[model samples]
Target chain A: MSAAMTQASSQAMSHAATDKRCDVSVKDVEISFGRHVVLEKLSLDIAQSEFIVLLGPSGCGKSTLLNAISGLLDVNAGQIWIGGRNVTWEEPKDRGIAMVFQSYALYPRMSVRENMSFGLRVAGMPANEIQKRVADAATMLKITELLDRKPSQLSGGQRQRVAIGRALVRDAGVYLFDEPLSNLDAQLRAELRVEIKRLHQRLRATMIYVTHDQIEALTLADRIAVMKDRVIQQLDTPQKIYREPVNRFVASFVGSPAMNFMPGRVERGATGATFSLGDLSIPIQGYPFKSPGLTGAAVLGIRPEHVLSGAEAGPNAFNAQVEMAEPMGADTLVWCRTPSGASFSVRVDSGPSIAPGDTLPVSFPVGTLSLFEEGPDGRRL
Target chain B: MLAIRPRLASRLAAWVALSPALAVLVVVYIGCTTWTIWISMTASRMLPSSNFVGLRQYEALFANERWTVSVSNLVIFGTMFMIASLALGFLLAVAIDQRVRAENLLRSIFLYPFSMSFVVTGLVWQWVLNPTFGIERIGKNLGFADFKFDWIVRQDMVIYCLVFAAVWHAAGLVMAIMLAGLRGIDEDIWKAARVDGLPTWRVYVSIVVPMMGASFATASVLMATSVVRLYDLSVAMTNGGPGIASEVPAKFVMDHLFERQNIGLATAAATSMLITVAAVVGPFLYWQSRRRAAAGAH
Candidate 1:
């Protein structure tokens, strides 16, 4: 009995780690509104000072997951750990997480200083300490001169900075952001995105940001968690996700203009298994399809940039009819239809003035092909 | 060959439409107010008289201890009632705004009080607060025979009873105003404050209340006006009974004007109240409007 008690006490002591542990950990989290589930069995482990972005399509539970971390929405099943403390049922403040909102919810009647000091004041901190934190956060945000102005008196960018400053004054272990730049104009969004990146580097605070915009996720995150249909499709470095996506959703989600999924068939070739669409045969091998011989139907995931247009072709070159040419200043997007009636896009630096109905031979580099198995929901392919 | 610009014609038509309403407002409301002030200056009992009293009525008003007591009672009642009603109203509004079930039932329960006339309100409160016949008696029968709740009769504590019923009647309207304010709050604020690591109550206190300035102002003005014009609740509840304990300023002016047939003293009291209100309210309103104009500019 004494040995068992010793082991139990040691186990309990091991669970306790100071501020430098994993910043956020969600285990088997499920959130449902009545009967409709938004997030199901989602688990993620976030290391300290890592900037993680939740990127997904609308209704994909990215925002819901963020809320779960913030303790705004309770998970039906699962425990949330923040800085080595279980905070699944804790209040948002107790969880040591601060959030910046999409709409910049600044207090219209309060000056920037008061808005920043409100949380600390409510915690019954000394007035002088609250003022010091407010001043430091204001200076860090470059909003010291605007401290006396109310939110209504500030511009959208200024108000957003103050909102961020309000969160910074708390000096929590984690920061949660819910599409904080969605309210700004396009120009301001771009500018503030840079500012946020700089702020993250300076603070080295753990952050979990949610956004539907893939570019923001790609640019801002040290690690990106791509979500779809209440599940995390893939979580990896942004470049890895761009290069190697585990499934169709991750493949399509991580890139702009989306990756194209062309219907193809696997046929037995002399060397190995080869992909066939119409008369074109592209050789592919190994781990993606070894035993579960993809015969009936499969999808070939190819990005617009990978569809090379040149004199010499790669593995899967076929005749494609150009449907539309969209010139986007730096690069040209050539929308084409394949011989097998699949539509896709090709990116070129400066294409030979391709127009509608223009016939061109496009090649898909087989090494870059991401394959999905055929399933009933269509995600398997 | 038009006399003014095209936009000016629209302004002219607007002014033309407003002139009748403006005329009535100026003649009926402002004119009667000015006439009342003029009559109070004279030694008029039944009608306006030319005889100058030269501060005689003012001297008499100062000497009347009942009038003095009435003024003090009004101040006490007004402050307590306004603050209490506002707090209770805001709390009710916040609670209801949570979108709890049985919303319409709770709303009707709160709003039904505003549908009552002051006569009915005072009578109902009197019935409930009467020590021998009301809640105290009920409690006594329920086995607490030592119950002593005779605030309506006590001279020192009578104003509290007045505050209780007055707050009960006016808080509903304040709730409605605050509810509208609470509803107009952008849902994004709740989500943002949640993200900012604030508890629900902090969000309401720091974010929600501050953003609800216009609603609070509207509710406050409505309540304050009601405070100055408080009359019937006093008359029905206590009837200035138990030896003039619950008398308010409006009641004193009203009793002297109608029941006592002492128009000189009544008009004199009215004039004093007018001067007092102007002394306090005139500067306050000027400063408020000026600040509002400054805020609105640019």
Candidate 2:
């Protein structure tokens, strides 16, 4: 690892702990299996009644971090606290957290009632209470009829509801979901995602959900933690992570179709500063950011929506050849490329008539672009 | 043009593909049973005759001393062997599933017995259980000359020796079936049970074993069939010695058919064995269908 990368990882770990609002906080946690390091100095604070979503790509250590919090994995370094008590060495059940697995791990031979109440039954809960809890959770998931049915008899959606209900019956302070909706169809996933959100609101329970889908993160999270390369790249509210990402990785990762970028030079002029790409230069007219440090080597990052494609639009303008357009009835996403081979996209009222090889000069609006240092470090300035 | 249901073609093809197997099944299994039933009613010595004398063979079969002893031996041997094999196999499977090191090695050792012919297996177990030969000799070499494992010598105790050898022969196959079942189990059940604060033994008893229903069914069916058709192991191990002890249904039928020139009684015995199997298995199949239907409706 580079010295700069090492510094970033250490800095990320240094904020390992915060005042306990929820039951669990992980401080500078690092986990490795054999010679391969899976998570390094990962720090996260989960508050009570807060639904925190850990969003990242595969192998980015989001699940590993959750495992560390749940005591399923041992961290080579760092400490964990749960319920205002240090529980770094505690077992999973002792940590007061229940997990809804990605695959609904229902016992096939057991009826839905037994499936939900298996844990309680094993714990020697009274038969009456076990029955009551199973009934309550069955009613909550609208699975009263399904209580007598085995998991095999239920549909995918019902099984997922039952899985969630299994965790709910535990009444654990924190509920961890490990990409629980990844197995469902898109339509069912959307429906259950809303249902889970409503469930969180009504119950007012703390939930730590993990997924690679940023849409899910954006829709469900009170706070989103974007991870990359075994470290938390950025952790903030969904809006902040999208609007003001700390680095290039976070900026590109949290948006659909991702943010478009153009390698350019940062030029300082009389009125303000601007990013020069090809023959066109976009002036950073507002947003008081000093660009003298960026100099010539910097990347200009702008969201696709920020570029105006409609006839009636803002001051910054450039003519362009439209390459292609994808229409979705309400909005059309137009792909345009500059003569100098710089490409950008804009979503407008309707698509264009241009073909794939068409040339277009697209403008980069003022203050909508973010500048990043070029070469080895390449962090946002 | 005639219109067929969408699934008709595949259904037709399925029947077409199964015709040969279906023909053989009917001609061999059903035909043989009917023929065997016919021979039981005829007063035949070694060859079939047209003259029929009803129930004479069955009456004589029940009166025969050796036949009565054979029936008693089969019941004792089958019950003990099946129970012992199932228990030992399930335990071995559970032990191997504890993420033990050298799992494949352990599995191969358990499964190697299944690959051997019953001839070899019976011989090995007979030698091991021999009083003056194997166990006693080994014990004497270790300076304990009075180690008696002579169940093969006692008339009342010979069935137990047969059970020991049969269980040894069958348990390995049971272990393999159960291990496959255990491997197919979702990894999350272990985690969920652990999170539920269940101890290891409780998890196995309350969760793991109960969920392995399909595997248990497979093993039970295989073992039940073996119990009915048990022969080679008993012959090699005890030779029905110690006064007609350790005799099984298959051995009894064979002895009557070839050795004693009693085709009439042999066919009678075969018919009775078939009826016994149908009596036990008929209700079992019906119950399974009903349970499956009930499970499906919910």
Candidate 3:
């Protein structure tokens, strides 16, 4: 038994290494449900073995884009190319892809082993080859003991693991995940998130994951595509997306405690441009403006963590009064109003005892502030 | 001591609450059953007379040609009706589950026949299958001069007419139950199956049908009980006519009890039916409970 178990595990470990990985390219795909267009002219190119996340709020077409890529939903126009093959008109199975659903949609009556091998069996693969693939997937998922158990017999996490194993057994070119962790509880969600990251690292397969949760997008994705209102706002590395959001929606949709915005006007001077908030004017000398001579009504955006207070708020700091403090274990978020009467939050270390109604000196560093045009689109300036 | 008093008082209240149902069980159900069994053993004709006779009524009941025809006819009708209704109902449910247009209207239309009484169904089918004015006449009127659809008048084929009407009446109910089962399946399961490259029919047979055990059990049990109590339809439609071809066990018992005044044989036939139903239902109920226990263990 021990020898057989070792052989099975070794065979399982050796499987993913030899599997072929493929890049996916969605070229200007448009999808609509009747007249309600969910995605319009969306195009994205994902590299081989890269982990790409489509992140947005509900109804932002993140899941719709993922479905179009997986061929679960048809696109109205444009072609999808996977590994250089145009598979826009192909069925989901013919497109050489596998998918994991949020609800862990394992066949309720089948045991885990049968669930994993169902696709292969339907494709008329040899029985022994199907068995070997199922065994390898079960071993890799640490569900060998659960192979004989029905989905209803397993907990939520175990069921999701089996669902992943079911997708894994397909050994397809690209894998799609449609909010697979949303149904799990928080603790299990965190554990499975780490496991998925590790699985991607080991397998080096192209994966397209869709989720509204920013933490999962940041932690698991090699590139994050922040989408909103039927369009992709930005597609970049997680660090770049976080620090250099292209618009107001992308900045506000990502990050916990969200970026703060203060409406102000920028006036051109002989020295340079200055952002004037009430009576106080801050110099925008070294700031990278999209247009060098741009001067108009603009919004100054700053993350809570980038705001400085107390000793770090030196002589050039602005004055503010604390409104309320929200204690979040690692750091306390202090809500404050500047002397110009604009309200914002500052992230301060929990050690300092900041309270409501306390006067403090706060500063916004020139390097970290984002300037946006004041009207609706709020394009970065 | 205080707790014991409350417990005793609550027990008294419980017994008070349960007395009506308990009285009905003992007086109506068990009481009538025992009295019928006892009467089957005694020779009672026209009037009640307690004279012992050892299985004589049963022996005569089996020997009688009409009773034999009734029993055999019941077996054939029961088999055909159950199979036809279950298959047709499952198919109807599958068609409706394909995200069809006006689903609510279609479901109501399909289930409309079940809401009607069996006698109404039998009368409608009786007129529709009457060779002179029904399909045969219509076919002849519409230009087929040699059409002959007269199953209701033929002895060998009359049971099939009964099967047809009974299926039309009961298939709607089974469809409703199976439709509910189909709706309970997760939409994601269908997506997964499509991604798995399984044909739609294979998924329905291998995955969807197996998962609908409870719906099948409910529909089958209801159909089985209706099969046992199948008297009104035959009386309303055929009246066991055409030389007593479509005669059933319930009709046999009813005719002997009320019209023929052969109480002993009627009671005997009724007892035999009761035994047969118990034989089929006992194992079925046992299996259901065992399955429930097994599921609960998980």
The candidate that achieves the highest lDDT relative to the unseen native structure:
3
Per-residue lDDT, model 2, residue A356, is 61
- Highest DockQ: give the candidate number: 3
Please give, for residues A332-374, the per-residue lDDT of candidate 3 as tens digits. 9999998889999999999979989999788888888899888
Q: Clashing residue pairs, candidate 1?
A: A99-B195, A373-A380
Q: Is candidate 2 or candidate 3 better by lDDT?
A: 3
- Candidate 2: tens digits of C-alpha lDDT, residues A143-181: 888888888878888998988888877666688898999
Model 3 TM: 0.91
Better of 1 and 2 by lDDT: 1
Q: Is candidate 2 or candidate 3 better by DockQ?
A: 3
The residue-by-residue lDDT of candidate 1 on B1-298, one tens digit each, is: 5766887989999999999999999999899788767666678776568787777777887799889888988899888988999999999999999899998899888988999998899999999999989988998999987988888888888789889998989888899999999998877677666555567887887678878889888988888888888889988998876688788788888998888876777888887888887897899899999998998995
**What's the true lDDT of residue B160 in model 3?**
98
Per-residue lDDT tens digits for candidate 1, residues A2-105, read 34323433322212122335478999999999999998888999998899999988889999999899888888999999988999898887777788888887
Query: Cα deviation in Å at residue A280, candidate 2?
Result: 1.8
Q: Candidate 3 lDDT, tens digit per residue, B173-287?
A: 8999999999999989999998999999999999999999999989998998999999999999999988899899999999999999989999999999999999988997899
Which residue pairs does candidate 3 place in steric collision? none
Model 2 Cα shift for residue B282 (angstroms): 2.9
DockQ values of all predictions: 0.46, 0.61, 0.76
DockQ of 1: 0.46
